[model samples]
Target chain A: MPYPKVDVDEWRLSVKGCVEEPLHLTYNDLLRLPQITQSVTLECAGNKRALRDPKTRGEQFLLGAISNAVWTGVPLQTILYLAGIRPEAQEIVFQGMDVGFRTDIPDLLSYSRSLPVTKAIHPDTLLALFMNYEPLPAKHGFPVRLVVPGWYAMGSVKWLRRILVIEHPFDGPYQSRDYVLYTRPDDYAHGVPITEIQVNSSIAYPTDQQTVRRGNQYVYGIAWSGSNNVTEIDISTDGGHIWQPADWIDSEQRYTWRRWSFHWKADLPGEYMIMSRASDESGAVQRQQALWNVKGYVNNSIHQVKVYVE
Target chain B: MPYPKVDVDEWRLSVKGCVEEPLHLTYNDLLRLPQITQSVTLECAGNKRALRDPKTRGEQFLLGAISNAVWTGVPLQTILYLAGIRPEAQEIVFQGMDVGFRTDIPDLLSYSRSLPVTKAIHPDTLLALFMNYEPLPAKHGFPVRLVVPGWYAMGSVKWLRRILVIEHPFDGPYQSRDYVLYTRPDDYAHGVPITEIQVNSSIAYPTDQQTVRRGNQYVYGIAWSGSNNVTEIDISTDGGHIWQPADWIDSEQRYTWRRWSFHWKADLPGEYMIMSRASDESGAVQRQQALWNVKGYVNNSIHQVKVYVE
Candidate 1:
């Protein structure tokens, strides 16, 4: 998709809906507010879409659909508090300037998604203006983008144009139709909205079918969990038959992936299968099989690799 | 295990038992015969032992317990034909010069394994003297190692010292006791002998949790089958939601792994789960779950990885 062009001089972030004051703030006004910076990991909801069984419909994404960066922005709660959010407001909807026509939808629609009032008031939620210490690139929702720390990237609407505080739920296309996980392919009525990222881990070294000289080798990878911090990582050099605890290479942090490594000696010459399983403080352990959903959301199965030692 | 020293000048390979003619051949005499070279992949029967759910015993080998090498040697059939096998012969037993005392067995025992006469006489079976164009390394069964191309490495008795044509099945410890796969963990009477390698594949690039720049990326891996050739490789960029056919990087060859790759474009910055599933000409497809075995043998489950794109 091409980046939607926005002229900063005429840009205004409109904050309306169930609030005491409806405010229109220019780009400079947002920059003038007290700024904060934080590092967060963002993962696409459809990250492992291709790994789902029975298949799914959408862009087939691999593990590279996620990234981490330092974002600079104003706390979303500050804006909500300044606007004096009405007590009756049930949800806050953020809309993007980018518009597109979808085959499933009759009218051209601007991308938008909603968050509960509780989440909107959370201090970690941000109206981000900068990524990695620089102004956001046009592709990354320049001018302003909503950053929801614990939810999937789909909830973090980009190219912010307006915010609406609604007394009831917002049934937008992205919320009502897309990004909904239908247990049965045809059962859309009981679909569930994808939210938190699942606890997961992946093997990074001695990659699948990688051949290495028989000796000491390090099996490295990363692990992450939504909201909760990753607490343990297990390494299985021989597939999942037996697991040995792995050491953390990075300290624990919320909303960011953790790096881990296991010291392994490939003393014998032959083929091997390697695996990594992760668990989070929330007590979520990476399973051998992820639940099947029509949209292929939230897959956190154990990662595996086949390696050869020569 | 340390390699035992062998005085080549005085060492001889004895062929006896049910053979019509018993014979002893010196190292130089065997080398003078017709020689052939082939690339074969040898896997340990206990490979992926750590992947077994219940956790099997023995050396906790990973995928590296296997390797492919160009072996030069005289076919076992040529030697068997010279020795003139009798019609009553049922199996051919091969023993290594190395001996050891085990806790389970009181007396010293040589590492011995037997093969059916049909497998023993197969033209592909060899008494290998050279590995990758070089003389066999001491640790890799110096002098002559029985190279059973399609079977597990357990059948390839190293440090060849003796061969026997038996009228009945050889009930050696390596055959009836150790290498046997007990289905119920205690069902000694219903155990199966581990043999032929299963069809399998592994991803070698975009390692698990690897962060790559959003652009064109090559997802590379390798696939191999026991006696059959790998006919297809399917790549899934999203956990397993959908699959696309992968291109073969190397032509199909028997007994050796074939390289494969998928050209992937990490156009968007996010997390993705990558997987590779392989199918052989024998109609064997790499499944999501490997069957549970007491010894964790023949695990050919699909391989996966988690990668991040920036």
Candidate 2:
């Protein structure tokens, strides 16, 4: 579905439910507040779907969908504080302006998700109004959007409309079911909510299966971790037989990926499986085998590419 | 030398000599005139200099010096028409605001170049004031710059201050001495001014000498011709013995390079030499051996990369 054609003058963001004093604000009201700008990278949860299986169930997006932009907005915590959250509030539900009927659910519903009150009031969580120093484009959420730093892009709800403070945990379909990771391949009996990003890396150059001449060559890619800074990236040329560290191209930035490069001298010819794995400061390393789920959520498995040396 | 910081308010571009009336225009005056915009690639004359022999004279620039941007300004033809060129005019000389002493000439000279009157009034030639939709950055020629599309960056002089019409051909050191191509390796006696770009292609991915794993791979790069649209890009994976056509990624854009990609299946693990050559619609093909020049101005020889698959 396309983004809702919202009338900025008529759009009123309501902060009700468990709030001590309910409040509704126009688009201009949000801009009047002190705004801070930050550069952040938002990666879709299923960014490497095509690599997992040639016929994945979801859109087979490559790494290009990810982008870093300067976002300017007011911190969600600032507004929550002004609304005077009730002591009983346990979660905050953010509803997007976009609405449609789900095949699985009979009733028409607006796309929404709920976050624990603690996560909602985090300083990094923002109600973003600008992107790349300009008013956000409609495709990227025009009037306002929610930005959850260090988390999967789904957490940063777009076309944000309502923020409801709930006294108990809110179990919306998107929050409790859709974005869940099924650790076992076959069954969906046990699952966990997908939150922070897994340690991940992808080769940006010498695109997948690139043919190269035999010689000393450089391999480079970008790596990132959701909740923690990427500590190191390792490249494997002999199907994990030997590993070497790739040099970091830039200093690590919080909530942003870092570029790395590795030099490899190919003395022999033939086919080689080149793979890159990333580890975060939190001791989280990309897994060789991703935990399969029907929805293909956080599949941060090691990224591999094949190349021919002629 | 750093960019000469010229006050925009004090700067006035003068069009004089061999004209019915001399014209003096401020920055605002240029913007007020009918404007045209185009996206053109500006490549330095010495781009890819490091690829040449180390003994080659002139600054060795790598690949980063080339950039493409949307330039908005009045066409040089429009301004020249307004000044009313005389039939006696043979050349149009452009002088930059920067002043420096040339050790060879032993005189303070504002860097300048002259184009034949016929070339000066070409519709694509622009007196650009804006780059990428924003006012040109100071380092990129702040108030105004001359943009000669499809020519080497030196032809697009920056920090432009004056345009002089001449009845005789220009013989400036830069035009006749520096940016000349020496056909013979050992002698500079037979030289010609470097004009339009040579048919060229460069590997943007799997950079120089990168190693990859054994498997299917895609080789892609950008190709462009100086005076005509790129027609075909051929890839040689077997040391230039076997050549294959790469698929064009997008429709051709005038004055812009086209991206092309090829699929290669790496079945053996070994070393290989990969090379790409471009051909233009004008029947100009990239040469296997570049013309040996003292300045290394147009080194559009076939680009080769050595990679090891293991």
Where does candidate 2 stray beyond 4 Å?
A1-310, B185-189
Best by TM-score: 1
- The deviation in Å at residue B83 for candidate 1 is 59
RMSD of 1: 14.7
The i-RMS of candidate 1 is 13.3
TM-score of 2: 0.51
In order, what is each prediction's RMSD in angstroms?
14.7, 13.1
- Against the true structure, candidate 1 reaches a TM-score of 0.52
TM-scores, one per candidate: 0.52, 0.51
The residue-by-residue lDDT of candidate 1 on B1-310, one tens digit each, is 5787788899899999988788899999888999999999888877666445455545555456778899999999998999999999999999998898654566898999999998998999999999999999988888999999878789989999999999998898889877776768556788888778888887878665456767788999888888888899999999999999999988988888888989998799787999899998989998987766655667677878778775
Question: What iRMS does model 2 reach?
Answer: 19.7
lDDT of 2 by residue, A1-310 (tens): 6778889999999999988788898999999999988878898887876566422345545566577788999999999999999999999999998888643466889889888888888888899999999998998987999988888898888898899999887788887767888766556678888888888999775565455667787888999988698999999988788999999997888888899999988767777788999999999898888877766667788988776664
TM-score of chain B of 2: 0.95
User: What is the docking quality class of candidate 2?
Assistant: incorrect
